[model samples]
Target: MSITTYGLQHIKKETQHLSQEQLSELLLRLARYKKENKELLAYLLFEAHDEAAFIEKVKGEAGFMFSQLSALSYHAAKGMRKILRLLSKYTKFAGSKEVEIELLLSFCVNYLEYADRRTTYKPIRLILTRQVEKVRGLIGKLHEDLQFDYLESYNNLLDDAEKKLIWFKKNDYQL
Candidate 1:
């Protein structure tokens, strides 16, 4: 049989009664048992108070992830997938649409700049296109000013990708 979950108020009250040491131990225990808990704890401790800094930190991480992509055609797509997964995890922890859009934009930029479509598989192109579409949808949900800002960035990314594609086609898909 499943146990009924306590209400948030009840849980908060119970948590407030714990001593500092007890709270620390409880947090450690929660983090140890689940990856999501660990990420949540990390955000609480390190990222939540400074969203802009956190976004910059994750963008740098994404750049590093992109840099690690293999030159070999076969491994490149797998590496891109791994980078995308890490970005998703970071975006989830940030818990903001702005962060999500920023990370996805970084992914698109990296995919265009670093990924060799001529050498890599078609699935990687599909993955990048899907993320671009997702980012567009997310931009529509933001406030008008923010949406305009992000839409401009999104357009630039697409333009760069298109330029690269045209160059690749003219060059007979050699990058």
Candidate 2:
């Protein structure tokens, strides 16, 4: 037997028929099943109203996570990955490229602050490089004005990373 899956339009139409109380109950039940669903719902209901505040909150959390990172390269890499996961989830909840770019930039800055760039750990280095590439890609998709602003910050970040980290090369991530 196969379960039926409806398109988003069909689901929206069906939901229009639901009474307010019924809709509320359905959303609550849906949120109960998965952690991601719950987080998305909470973001929509609360943080969606003030995106800047939400972004700042996520940045603060990332900073705190960075501060708690282990001095050992392997452990620090693991912790940095965890922070990336958190930023990825919150970016999904925001559903905006600009938010994604901002969160990613903030992550890179936090990583630079707490990370020991002198280490030969590939994973830790790759994490920063990957996020910089992601931010660079996303910046291109934005309006030209926005692109100019983010690109300045992106260049600054790359300059700092190159100066501080042995693994990062300015030529590798250039636009």
Candidate 3:
């Protein structure tokens, strides 16, 4: 026999019938089962009210991670991928395109500053390229004025990458 599952609307309707104490208990129980769920709940409770502060805090953590990246090419690539995972999680929690773009831009800028530019590590290079493309796509979804502002920073990032990394081609990333 197979168990039944409900859609979000059904779940919401059911949840609405529960008392406040029961709802809180349910949420706490759910959070106790998964680390990500707990983090998301914590963000919603504390950091969601002050998005700017949250973004700055995340950026600072990313910066510290970048600074501590391994010297070896392969290890550095792994470290970068880990950082990207962290950013991806926070972006999901924030659920804002602007926040996503800002975090990604911070990743790219930190990469250019601290990564080994001369290494022929394909994964490392691909990480930056993929992130640049992602940022460009996200920027397109914003308002025209915001797009223009982000484009300036994006263009500057590409220019800086072109100058610093031998493998980076500005033409490929051009708007």
Candidate 4:
């Protein structure tokens, strides 16, 4: 599946109709991990924040679910948790010291395919613009991985998401 397909309007409509319990159950399932399945937490958080109501319902629960997983430091899940926290504030999201969205997504993608790709969530496949790789390079260009650079990385991600708004429009996102 190429990463450029935007089922944006359709996805928006579909997610809006989902009941809170239905959404919660999906997220709960996403949050689960087996004895050694490490990629589970990150992928679950990716799908939980499509709408504000959904975000309002699951952010805390997602937080709690990940807090336990955080202890395991499943390579990328902690980053996923922070990414979701930001996405949950959509519309209200003003941007911050952001990790590039592309990098964050790439991190998740790498984790997904680490063991198997077919079992991972599908939207990730849609984010195929190599945005993560470009962002990784940008960070490398700065050569500034510091104690506070982590905080600034989130802002960079926010800037990237806002840029996507303009990008999607130019690509003829009428729906």
Q: Give the worst 10-residue stretch by lDDT in candidate 3.
A: 166-175
Per-candidate TM vs. native? 0.82, 0.95, 0.96, 0.23
Give per-residue CA lDDT, model 1, range 1-175, as digits (tens).
Answer: 9999999999999999999999989889889999888888989897799998888888898898888888876688788888888888888887789999999998888888888856546677677777877888899889998998887788777777778764322122111
Write candidate 2's Cα lDDT for 1-175 as tens digits.
9999999999999999999999999999999999999999999998899999999999999999999999999999999989988998998899999999999999999988999978988888888889999998999899999999899999999999988887689898888
Candidate 4: where are CA atoms >4 Å away? 1-94, 99-116, 119-131, 137-175
lDDT values for all models = 0.81, 0.92, 0.95, 0.41
Which residue ranges in model 3 land beyond 4 Å of their true spot?
none
Worst 10 residues of 2 by lDDT: 117-126
Arranged by TM-score with the best first, the candidates are 3, 2, 1, 4
Candidate with maximal TM-score: 3
Which 10-residue span in candidate 1 carries the lowest summed lDDT? 166-175
Tell how far residue 92 is off in model 4, in angstroms: 6.5
Could you tell me the lDDT of residue 128 within candidate 1?
A: 74
What TM-score does candidate 2 reach?
A: 0.95
Q: Judged by lDDT relative to the true structure, which candidate is superior, 1 or 3? A: 3
Name the candidate, 1 or 3, with the larger TM-score value. Answer: 3
Instruction: Say which prediction, candidate 2 or candidate 3, comes out ahead on lDDT.
Output: 3
**Is 2 or 4 the stronger prediction by TM-score?**
2
Kindly indicate the candidate among 1 and 4 with the higher lDDT. Answer: 1
On a 0 to 100 scale, what is the lDDT of residue 128 in model 3?
Answer: 96
